[model samples]
Target: MLLAIDVGNTRIKAAVFEANTLFDAFIFVKEEFAEKIEIILQQHPKITTMVVASVGNLDPSAFSSFEKRTKIEFISHKTKFPFQNLYATPNTLGIDRMVLAAGAVLQFPKQNRLIIDAGTCITYDFVDADDRYLGGAISPGITLRYESLHHFTAKLPLLTKSYPENFIGNSTTESMHSGVVNGVISEIDSFIENYKTRYAKFIIILTGGDADFLAKRLKNTIFANSNFLLESLNQTFQYNQK
Candidate 1:
């Protein structure tokens, strides 16, 4: 059995896997180390290999303690990844992003792939069928778009990022929502439009917190798997083990 943990800026997701099949998982928000991990250890005592991809300030000491207690080694950025890393700064690359590319490779084994992770930030990564990571692009998410407007302007209140009443907004709140959500839709459309000119028939995979929120809003069709990063973690762990 294997244990994969993905620690994001706002929350943490941990999943148990058995022979390439995910078992159970849990989501933990930002909180001090309580008995939560201890409980997890007890629940999956058979988890022989542990992998952690953290985007936050994760203490190595805690994972070390798990190693000592569960007799399982931890997989990290230091762990060898299977694909050829093309990122200019490998050390600076986010683990979540790496896992995502790995996941894309496994899911669409022989096809060009594009992964769009829409969370606190939106990241666009691509991988070739030969397992070449072509790198990715990143930008502020919808919420950040709203927050930026408020921060940049004096009277513009911090509007929530959601679907607009209509594309043609007739009010302030509606206009803000339209700018954030509809803007994202158009931005994605433009990216796809350009990418299509370069690559023919690359599969588009979308995931992350804001994925569902804007999945239907997308102008172009996309495959949405909210647990993509976790699946990627599992694949990465297995790849390193072999």
Candidate 2:
């Protein structure tokens, strides 16, 4: 079995995969990194190889517990990927985004792909049909929007994410929900429409903590899987072995 870990800005997700089939998956916060990973290690002794893709400030030492038992690797710009990265600022590209692009290529071949990750930040990454990764955009995510509203302005209390009761919010909390949730839905739909105008037969992949929340609201067809980055990490590791 192979262990794949994706440490994002907000959460750390780990999964055990036997070939392409996922055996088990776990998600936790960074503070629980050592404890959670240790438990996962104890539970899945068959995971001989571990690969991590991180876009957070997690210390590398957190994985030392696994190092003694498995061959571990971290994904960086230096890591080998199947897709050709054409981003102007290659060093600035997030390893998580790069892995997602690689996963799209491996999972869905011969097509243009747009990957939207909705977590701390909503990131849009595009990989063309020819397997060249052209950079995409990033925007404030669901939580960020709520936090921004509360932080930047006075009297707007920080609110947990919830779908707007109606498009036309009647109260203060309702308005904030509409602006944050409905606004993001509109923004995503606009991006999909624009991408469609330029590319034909393109596939949109939505992943991250807020994927399920946005999936129901999005009008465009998308393959939504929250574990995409972890899956891609395993795919990248397997490809490197070959």
Question: What TM-scores do the predictions have?
Answer: 0.89, 0.98
Candidate models: Cα lDDT each: 0.81, 0.92
Clashing pairs in 2: none
Worst 10 residues of 2 by lDDT: 59-68
Off by over 4 Å in 2: none
Candidate 2, residue 212: how far the Cα is off, in Å: 0.7
Error of 2 at 123 (Å): 0.6
Candidate 2 lDDT by residue in tens digits, 181-224: 99999999999999988887799999999999999889999999
Candidate 2, residue 222: lDDT = 94
Number of clashing pairs per prediction, in order: 0, 0
User: What does the lDDT come to for candidate 2?
Assistant: 0.92
Q: List the residue pairs that clash in candidate 1.
A: none
